[model samples]
Target: MTDKNPFSRRQFLAATSGVMGAAKLYGQGAAGEATPAAKLALQGGPKAVQGGLPQLVRWGQPERERMNALIDQTNLFYWKGPQTTLLIDRFRQTCPLEHVMTCSSGTAALHIAVAAAGIEPGDEVITSPISDIGTVIGVIYQQAVPVFADLGRNTYNLDPEDVARRITPKTKAIIAVHLAGNPCDMHALKTLADQHNLVLIEDCAQAWGAKFRDKPIGTVGHIGCFSLQAAKHVTSGEGGVVASNDPRFGPLLQRFGDKGMDRLAKGGLFEVFATNYRMSEPQAGFAAAQLTRVEGIAEKRSRLGNLLNDKIASTPGIEPHQVHPDDRSTYWFLMFRVRPESFKCERAEFVKALVAEGVPASAGYIPVPLYGNPVFQKHGFFAGRWPLKEQGLTTMDYAQVACPEAEAILKTGVRVTIHEGMGEAYVLSLATAVRKVATHYAH
Candidate 1:
C-alpha cells in the first residue's frame, strides 16, 4: 500500500537500509562466501555505463502544431496575441499562481519583479550567494545593493537564519533562489518576510515543477520568476515569466513587462517608467506546448533521481542531495558533495575516476561565489561604478564580501544533469560507478 504519511528523512534512510540489505545478499556466493570485489574502471575494468544516456527532446509534434496554429492565425505580435494568451493560460493552469506576465528572458522577469516590488535606488535585496549572476543583475540594474547570504550545508538552499542576519534597515526585498530545482524553506522565509515587511521574490529558474510542503514553489513568494532559457526544464529558445498571487504586484507585473504601458487599459498612455521586456508570440507558442510535456519529464527525473540517491546513500564520504521530507525536488541537475577528510583523493581526482567509470559528472558549478565575479567586485554594473555606491548610501564592497558556506560548496559539490529518458538500469549503473570510485578512495 502507498504510505499516506509524508516521507521523512528517517523513513528514507530506513527504506534505503532494506535495499542495501538486498544488495548485500545478492553479492554473497552460494557457499556463503563473499564475492570478490569488482575491478575499478580506472584500473582497466569494464565501464559501468556503456552507451549514451537519453536526451531531452525539445521539439515534437505538439510544438509543431502550436507553431503552425500561430502561423495560420497570422498574429505574430505578442500584444493581444492569442499565442501569448494561450501560454499564460497554460502557465496559470500548471502553477498555483493567480497572475503571470511573459517577458523576454528570465533576467527580464526578475527585473520586472524588482520594479513591481517598488525597489528604490540604494535599497538592499538579500539573496543566495551560490546562484547565477542573473539573480543579482536585476537588483544591480535597479541601483540597489545585492546583499549575499550564506546557504545551508546540506539543503544548498538559502539558510533562513543567515537571511535574517543579513537584513538591515536598508533591506527592501529578499530573492530566494531555488537552486538546482530544490525548494528553499519557504515557510521560514515567508514568516521572515512578513515579520520584516519585505517583499519576497522567488527565482525558480531551475525549479519548474518542484513543490515545497505540497505547495507550488513560486506561490509562496510575493513574485515568482521563471526562465524558459534553452537549458531550463521548459524552453522557448529564450523567454521568462513572472507570476504572483499578491493583488498589489499583479498590475505592476503587467505594466513593467510591457514597457510601463497598461495594455489592458482603455487609453494608450504610459503610466509608469519601464523598459520593453516582452516575449514574442512565437516563443509563447513554443512555451505553451512545452508546458504540456513538463509533468512527464518531472516524473521520470524524480523517480530515477530518488533511486540513484537511495543506492548511493551508504557510499562513504558522499552525501546525496538533501531534500525536505515534504518537498519534491525536480532535480534539474543532480548534485552531491564529498566530505574532504573522509576520502583519500581530492574532488577532481574523484570526478576523474567516476568519469573513467563512464559516469558523467562535474566537480562543481561556479568556481566562486557571485560576489567574487569581476563585475560585482569592480562595481561595474553601470559604466564601472554603480550610482548607488557613488551616492554613498551604503559602503558595501563585493570584493571584501564573504560567504564561507557557499565557498565550501563550490569546493566540494558535484553535479550531473538529470533527464526524463534515463531508465532504471542506467540510474543503477550510475550508482555503481559512484560506489566503485568512492570506495577505492575511501580513507
Candidate 2:
C-alpha cells in the first residue's frame, strides 16, 4: 500500500466485502441476502404473489406491448383516441372519484385545480415548504400568492397547527401534500379548511393509493391532483389527472384545458382559449395498464418496509420515518433520518458509503423553500411591485416564517427506492449497507 494509492482495486473490493460481512454478523435475515422464511411469513400464505421482484420484469413485457400497440394507432392531426377515453374511465373507476380529467402534466393538473378552486389574483394559498415547487408555481400561475407553512419535526407532512396560524383574511385555499406517499392528517386539515371555508386541494403526486382511515387520500380533500410522470407509480411518460367530488369544479376544470368549451363535440377543433395540454393516447394507454397493478405493487412495498423496520430499527443513528396509525401508506421513497450524534460522518458521507455498498441510497428531495427560490425573489414574469427589479411581481417575504422540521429534512434526510421491484433481499441489502456505513463512521 502506498500513500497516493493506499489499496489496489482488488484490495478495495475485498475490504468492502469484509465490511459487509461484519454488518451481516450484526444484522438479521439471510447470510447471502436471500428472502428468509420469516419474511415469507409476512406474505400470509402460499396464495400470495410468487414473483415480487420479477413481477416488475413480467409487467415490463406487457407494458412494452401496450405501448407499441398505442404507437401504431397514433395520428399527427390530434391526440384524441379511444385509449385516452379508456384510461379516463379506468382511472375514474380505480380511484372511485366523482370526476377525472386527463391533463398534459401534473403541473397542468395542479394549475387547473387551483383555477377551478377560484383562486384569483392576489389570493393567498398556504402549503408546506418541504414539497416540490408545483404548489407555489400553480398559485403563481393563477396570479395568486403562496403562503409557506411549516412541517412537523416527526413526519415531514405539513403541520395543521402551523397551517391554521398562517391563514389570513386574504387566504383562499390550502394545498396539502402527502409527502413520500404517507397520507396527511386529512381529518385535522379538513376541520381547519371547513372552519375557514377554504378550498382544500390534495397534492397526491407522491401518493397514488395511500389511504387515511380506509379512505383514499385524494378523496378526502375537495379536489386532488395525481402525477403519472415517468418515475411515478403509474407512468404515462408525462400525464396528470385531477379528481373532484364537486360537480361544478369538474366541468370547469375540463374547460381550463380546452379554453371554455363545455363539451368536446361542440368545437371547430380548438374553440376554447385553452392551450394543447391534452394527454396522448399512447401514454394514457400505457398508464392504464400500469394502474391495474398499483394496489398489488403498493402491498409489496409495505411488506418490504416492514422487513426493513424489523432489521434496521435498532441500528444506531438510523431512524426511519414513522407512519401514523391512521395512514395506510403507499411507499414512494423509503426515508431514514440520521441521528448524527451517534455517527462520526455527515449524512452526505453516510449516503455516499451506502451507494458504494451497492444500495441505491442518497440524500434526497431538498426543495428550494417557496419564498426563497429565484422565481419568486426576482420577478420578471408577473405584473406587480418588483422591489428588486424596479417593476414586476411583488417581492416575496422570506422572513418571519420558519420550518424547523423541513429545514432539518432539507439539510440531512437520506432516501432509497421503495419501488415495487424491491424485495426482502433488497431490503436486507439496504439494512446491511446502512449498518456497515453507520459502524464505519461510529469508529
Q: Among all windows of ten consecutive residues in candidate 2, which has the lowest summed lDDT?
A: 39-48
The candidate scoring highest on lDDT is 1
Local lDDT at 22 for model 2: 35
* Residue 249 lDDT in candidate 2: 76
Name the TM-score of candidate 2.
Answer: 0.80
After superposition, the stretches of candidate 1 with alpha carbons farther than 4 Å from their true spots are 1-7, 11-36
Residue-level lDDT of model 2, residues 1-443, one tens digit each, is 10011123443243223232233333333223322222121123221122233335425765787777766874622235667676777777667777677887788788888888888777788898877776567777677777888876546788899999988888889999888787788889999999999999999988877777678778988898988888777777788888898776765777675555556565456443445456767677777787877777667665666456445544555665555544566768877677667677778887766666566667957655555566555554456443333433433465545667677766667887777777676666667666656655664
lDDT by residue for model 1 over 1-443, one digit each (tens)? 11112335674454333332223343332123333357777889878777876665677998999988976886688877888998999898768687889999999999999999999988999999888889988888888889999998757789899999989999999999999888999999999999999999999999888888777779889999999999998999999999999998977898998889998898888978999999999999999999998777766666777667656655657767766666777888888888798789899999988888788799889878999989888988887777787889779999889889889888999887677778788887888777777667877
Clashes of 1: 0
The residue-level lDDT of candidate 2 at 264 comes to 55
Candidate 1, residue 256: the lDDT equals 94
